[model samples]
Target chain A: MSVSTSQALDYLEQLPVQTHRKLYEQPSTVLAIFRCMLPHLAKSIVMGMLYMPTPISSPDLDAWFRPSAAKLKRSSLEILEKLHIVSQKQLDAVKHTAFTLSPGFAKSLRQALEGSGTHRSFGVPAPPTSARKVSVAELDDYARIQWESILFYMVGSTVGFHGGGGMARDIGKGTRSLLEAGDFVGKKFGGGVGITRTGFMFVLQDTNAQVWSLLIEYLKHVNQLGMSETDVLSFLFMLGSLELGQDYSTSTLSPTQLQMLIDLTAFGLVYRTSENASTFYPTRLATTLTSDSGALSATNNPHDHAPAPSGGATQKGFIIVETNYRIYAYTSSLLQIAVLSLFCKLTTRFPNLVSGKLTRASISRAVQTGISADQILSYLDSHAHPQMQKSVPFLPPTVTDQIRLWELEGERLECTDGYMLREFPSDKDYRDMVKYAEDLGVLVWKDDGERKFFVNRIEQMQEALKKQGQRRAR
Target chain B: MVKAVRGTLVKCDASIKAMLVDIDSKNNNDFIIEELDEEHMLVKETKVNALKNRLQQMMKDRLKDPTIDEDSGKE
Candidate 1:
């Protein structure tokens, strides 16, 4: 799974079971979750039990999966159980635990797969005779322009770059406040924009992940707006299933989704002829939301291979770096220039090209702003010009090493905000809980001799310790 | 009973840890919550950034910055 899918999946998994049930009522939402949210083995498990006449016994599941693959089986089943997709039931006749796919999930997923449902969860297409004809290229351009407004709002303000004199000023009030709430940006000392660490990471993530991150924030604040969370989520999933350049009807949508349509239009996910246009087209951004292609590889043309970026924008890798650390980029897009200006000290700019040099001062300045050396290097690597692609390593090794050294110069200590675990009742208890914490990926530091450890999280360790305490009392 | 203390864990070399301890002491003993081991210590959660800035300033005063061609290296 791409990092983007994991993010959305994490949010979905945390939703209450009741909300999951409501979300599963929609075929499009169910289909989107099944396609991108579930682990590979979980998907296979779901498929195996999808049409089964009876629930499969837990022992039978063990029989199906090889014993050597037990861990994978357990993990996959755990995820399925968490999502309420698969429920364990008492087989009254057999005296065993049997797993059945949740009725709502099974039915909706089946409908999605078979394309046989009256739920009309999928978007209703606009009539063929409709005058609005949007080409895929035009849709891509629109999506790019609309998405850039949000990005420029976050990056431009912090870096002191104004995205002057365009529709960039049409940044919606709803979107701006959402960014602030998400800590992607905050009002600075002078009442301008200050990019928080979370905001910096959000801006650096790929276009698709960026969209999901913002939409997830929107999802969080939906209840305050008196909108149904399921309605908003299902509409987003419905947008994912929609075809690019194809227009859909607004008449079929609920009021909350209609309001969402206005917000999503601001985000550039869907485009309409006008504010009141009855038909709207889902841009490349919307179509790629639930996609597994990783980044918003909006271009339907498969051969356009530029392994996309967690960098700012522009899919075509346009940067070229020399051994001396001087850089040249061929592009006229302000968004692209603004992103480049994050790590490089630009010396000259022409209509079609900009020249810059990576200096120690510039890299350190970016690091000070919470942009890491690795992010800068990956941005360079992924966006390396086509000519530079002929080389073994995309970026010049010397410059990359120097950039890392400069970033490392300022780093004296690493700090993690968490709890330190210590003073266990028994040696065995300390050892066992430390092992569990290690497995949970929360153990920050440990000393077996001292019988104390530091952990980045505490709830699970607390539960284990409590259980151990209970066992001792028993 | 296993006890968990809530704070920010800082990891550095022994020298840096000693410097942090000295810095914390000079700051009226406000930054550190507990010192766990040779290279690890727990400090006040909200004071991590302020402590970082202090460390950076001290390093500037104590260590010589070795960048020679930074200005002239750029085009």
Candidate 2:
């Protein structure tokens, strides 16, 4: 599971019923979660049921998923239920058990997909004409400069570079404080703000993950400040849906949202002329939040020929890695170079190129900063060049295996944080439930005589048990 | 598999209904043409009768005009 999902689910769990109701009032949030958070097949199930009048019978849904995909289907449904996006139902007349989307979620998702409702939650396009039009390049320039400033603010103080004079802008104090609170930067024993392990890990992430990581941190702080989490979350989702390069009317936003717009502007998620710009334009960073990791990977790597516009806030990768650990990055962006420098030992530099080797030293230095080898490999794989993308494996096999092997040198034990279930009434019940859990792919461990089972994801275990009982009744 | 109808909203609907409109002898001039009054909407011939007659007359007028003879001679 990705960090975003666990974090998102945790946030969802904390929401009061009323908050969920209010959040679901806007269809965009429903659509965003439906599109981005659900597994591939979960989406299929949701769409299949989105228009149907009756609850989807549990048996029918079971039949719908292929036998081989039974586990995936069960896991998917459990996630949906846990998030309160769907519910299981029993109607006495038919003696049928069915699954249905939670009413609020169903209605809002329908509105989102159909683009109906007066909510105007998708951000009303600046009423057909706004005289002050901003070009995509201007927006990218704004995003890059603003984002780089924040990064520099964090990394600069450590390297003894105080922004090197007259940059486009310096990151604001609030953002710096938030970063410190998030532990992205820490006060060292020497009393200077030093880039922490989390910061290093953050810097190496694809731009999309980086954006989410920062925003999630910001969300936590917002919650701490006695602000409404629902307002902050819904506003963030609304920002994600806004069209890049088009200004959105701020009049319809809440006070918390209005405050967020300013903070978001500082982080380069949006652009505005003044502190009180009537309308704000979301950058590509803001808009691509709901896109899948695959799309995120494509957008980040320019050499992948993903057709992302050059001047937008979309990330473009230019690095090529080989099985022999040789690396060639075809870019001159200073920020990119700085990031690469963090995890790769530089051997040469050309006018429009940089050559580096992923040596043990480089990998260990990064691992020491709390970035795992898997993170580095995944980043490399995602940003692999187009030619590399065409191959069966994105990253070179030798390099990928070696990175893991090196990390294994440091990591000897693996730990899973989850719950254990035991003390079933009978062996039959235990066996039946264990199989159900296994089918859902949530059974981490089980002991036969002990009549005990363990599941890494508890949300699914409960659903499986409920479903098993429904099945037994028949 | 169900084929999805795709396009601007108007064109999607237009593609469904426009098959009935007669274009062969109506001069193919549809510009500025309002959809024929609702009562005669279903009958192709009745809807196009006036436009068809006007088109034939215009073509004949163009052939008979003296300016047409002069333009052809120059060419």
Give the number of the best model, judged by TM-score: 1
Using all chains and alpha carbons, the TM-scores for the candidates as numbered come to: 0.88, 0.71
Give the per-residue lDDT digits (tens) of candidate 1, residues A1-474.
788888998898889999999999999999999998888999999999999988888888889888877767877887898899999897785457899999999999999999896998898998898374988767666676778778887777765667564524668789889999988898888778878878767776777788899999999999999999989999999999998778999999999999999999888898988999888999878888888764344444754433433223656678999999899998776667777888899989998789998888888888887888888887788788999999979887898899999998767789898988888888988988887887667888988988888888786678778878888997
Model 2, position B9, has a per-residue lDDT of 11
Give candidate 1 misplaced runs (Cα > 4 Å): A52-78, A86-101, A130-132, A158-169, A189-191, A194-196, A294-312, B27-29, B68-75
**Across residues A176-291, which tens digit of lDDT does each residue of candidate 2 receive?**
89999889999988788888888987776666767888888888888767678788888888877777667788888888888888889989889998888788888777877766
Best by DockQ: 1
Chain B alone, candidate 2, TM-score of 0.26
Candidate 1 scores a C-alpha RMSD against the true structure in Å of 3.9
**For model 2, which pairs clash?**
A300-A317, A301-A317, A302-A317
**What lDDT does the true structure give each of the candidates?**
0.84, 0.68
Local error of candidate 1 at A281, Å?
1.3
**What i-RMS does each candidate reach, in Å?**
0.9, 27.4
lDDT of 2 by residue, B1-75 (tens): 111111111111242224323443244644212232221122222334443344345445554645446635744
Q: Which regions of candidate 2 deviate over 4 angstroms?
A: A1-14, A54-69, A90-96, A128-130, A156-162, A165-169, A293-334, A346-357, A381-398, A420-429, A446-453, A457-474, B1-75
lDDT of 1 by residue, B1-75 (tens): 677788898989899888888999998999999887888889989999899888888888998766645575533
